[model samples]
Target chain A: MIDAARERIIDCDWHYQDSFKEVAAYMPEPWRTKYKHSNWDDAGVKQNLSSFFPTSTGDRQNYGKVVREHSNYPDEPEEPERVREGMDFLDIDVSLQISHLILAMGGVNADDKRVQAFTKGYVEYMLEEVLDPDDGVYGLAPMPYSDVEASLDILDRIEDEEAYVGACFVTAGASPPLGSRKYDPIYERCEDLDLPVVYHTGGSGLDEYVRAGYQEMIETHTLGFLESNMSQIVSVACQGIPEKYPDLDIVFMESGVTYIPGLISRLDEEYLKRPEEAPLLDTRPSEYITDFYFGTQPLEISARNELLELCFDMIGTDRLLYASDYPHWDFDSPSIINDLPMLDDDDRRAILAGNAEGVFGL
Target chain B: MSDGLVEVGPATEFEDGDHAIVEVGRAEVGVVRADGEFYALRNQCPHDGGPVCKGIVQRELLGEFTGTGERVEQYYGEECIISCPWHGWSFELETGTHIGDERIQLPMYDVVVEDGIVYVDTGE
Candidate 1:
């Protein structure tokens, strides 16, 4: 059933993390010595594996057992071969991949030469080696929010690359909000380049706003994405970023679609009360919201129909994009979305392909 | 006021201070009474699908027309407004309009009282 839409499918919200060794190479000298040496390595990898899955490692060959039983490669893949395997598993046609830290979840720092070096290196490597080689893969370039000028400089260089589709910004705990004057340069760059800004769920530097002792990674990951995206939508709408840059697009990656209806209505309400503030916009917040897109995975079945209807009602069919979040814990099977109850053929087609084509200019 | 009558509930069932969650066909409708008139609307709140009937009723300050006749500071009190339990998206029961945003309107169901019993048209 998905065969027809297979070529059209564009998974807009997958993630890729560099190997610890690869990531550590760009870390500053002292952090390299302290964090990398203590937390990761050949031996540390083995120890971590054993601790995570003690019972499964008892009788089998050490290296083979560790790789087979406890490896998160199935959970998180960095290698191209593993990524292909993940795509095959989820039946996804294409993936737009972004990194958690490389994209500034910790906040972009221009003075931090280490971050600049690491991000540039990662972006170049991913584009040239990983995504460019495969027709089915795309890359979202990293943005350094700490220094918008430098980030725009990098964007100007990467804008023409076929593998590069957009820029990924860390939404969780972003200082000065996404719509502030501080980000005008970045927004201006995106507007000029026609690159959508992508926001992913988790990484470093959000510990301040997040509560302490929140042990479950799932809760933290979910809350972080939802809260961050919600605030981003509000800030952008209230501050008239969408109005300022009418052609610029934003993609809320990893955040589920459940919260969207409320956010849209809330923004609409706020706009009504403060029309003088957004004199540039000709329509309500919901009208501008339709210009943006969202990627959904681990598909929310319970309220899928209602959410889809509401989003479609406000944003139209061109805004919803399909994604699989390949190799993640709650990874969605391609067929799972096909099995959702009561969706019509046209809506399904939009969710799978047509919307994505419009989003990525494919 | 118009002849848009449908059997909603017993008049006593929806008191001045309370609301009734009525199922008319597949649609869940919220029935609330304020200012001596009963109002009915689709039960689902625009924000996150919170149950509107379960939300607290409150009065809020809305912008009012100014003294200069320019409609500035348009502040008005909407009594018996239902605030969604999830994210607080409020709607005035009398108009089915979102409290602050006048553009988005909740689907309203017609209601009438007959022999001390009230009826609401589900519009399904």
Candidate 2:
């Protein structure tokens, strides 16, 4: 079923809904017992805390009303066969299916041991039940950054697993930011293994939403991702993580590309005035920002071609990877990129798969 | 019934909230039935070229600010709308005007039911 007419497509951020109860079965003894017995009655917490906390405004899609009312997409926790069907529909050759629960790992307000245990459980479950790279269904190892040792161990375990092509850093509510020297060991390991690191962000900025009095999904959804990723860009670039690691393949997923121009300009503006504060950086912040790859899922199709091209030009077209956050309310079809007037065949091929092929070494 | 009219099907083919996409000359029109009337619109979405006719047909959701400046929302049952499946852009079924913006409208075709046959004046 491969479309010979086009280049191979690799979706970097295909999200898969993993059941908490199922992941719990993979958990080691005491945590498994605790997860099943815990009584968190608030519906929002109960519904999502098993994976990650829900957004302050609650579920973003109104609980799949769009799918029920308008779309023909399958429901969550789809079998691998169904996922293959989805990839086939989009003509995607490879999909790095991220677990929804593990995506919330960074945002979870829990003990490091509990987080590590659940992270291990989730990864193990994925390794056993979900991953099948031969079918182009690959996965990422969710790094529990709160404990560097544990994160390193998870990386070691997945280093040899063919299904695991990258390591994920859930960017919501990540303390000390990703640029902190505390995470150097994990970065070192990833660099050593030549595994790309994906910084996938979530909209569940619970504390930020509540503190900012964001009453609606629109408000929080709009700023939460931008705010989180922007902070990380500043943290990573200023703290010199890019310079220190040198070879760590870094990717910022979920957020669209438009934010890059503004954030980098702002970083450069501030960096020029306060070079003393961030002594580790050897070049302009924009140069490092351009080095990082970005996932184009929620690829802003609404923007006029010239504007989107401008953003791509700033980052160089090769750094952009096509990601379809499918089954979500705002999923982009491959046609969105395929039909864009601005992209010549070369631009389309690069964004669709070429960049990802190089980045993940597929 | 008329020479210029494009034959869609029998009038009975579409029930309330039902739709059928038909090729009319060079145009693809989605003929929908709502409240015992037929409305025809170009199947393609102006927003993103999505198949707008294949989307959900429902009452439009409306919002208003109350006297205290608090926002309240309700579904206005008087108007039936079709939302684009790709991005959920809603357009009025009868007029084909975007519910949120009058400037963006789906191309509409005139439908006439004659002697039990539904015909669309696709203006070929």
Q: By DockQ, who's the top model here?
A: 2
lDDT (Cα, tens digit) per residue for candidate 1, span A126-180: 7655784356788888776767776787798787887888888877657777878
In model 1, which regions exceed 4 Å deviation?
A1-7, A23-77, A107-111, A203-210, A213-219, B1-124
Docking class of 2: acceptable
lDDT of 1 by residue, B1-124 (tens): 1243446667876657467877766778887776667778888866435466666665665666567857457355756576664335677777888877887678788777778887775444
- Error in Å for residue A321 of model 1: 0.8
Clashing pairs in 2: none
Question: What is the C-alpha lDDT profile of model 2 across A1-362, one tens digit per residue?
Answer: 22324668888888766655667778777888876676432222224544464545645544332442322233334455667777787678898988666655555676547778878887898889878888988998888888999898898888789989999988877888989999989998999999999998875555365376667666777787767777887898899988888999999988898889998999899989998888888879899989999988677877877888899889988898988887566777666677777777787888888899899888
Clashes of each: 14, 0
What candidate 2 gets wrong by more than 4 Å, as runs, is A1-5, A36-59, A62-65, A68-76, A206-212, B1-13, B66-77
Number of the top lDDT candidate? 2
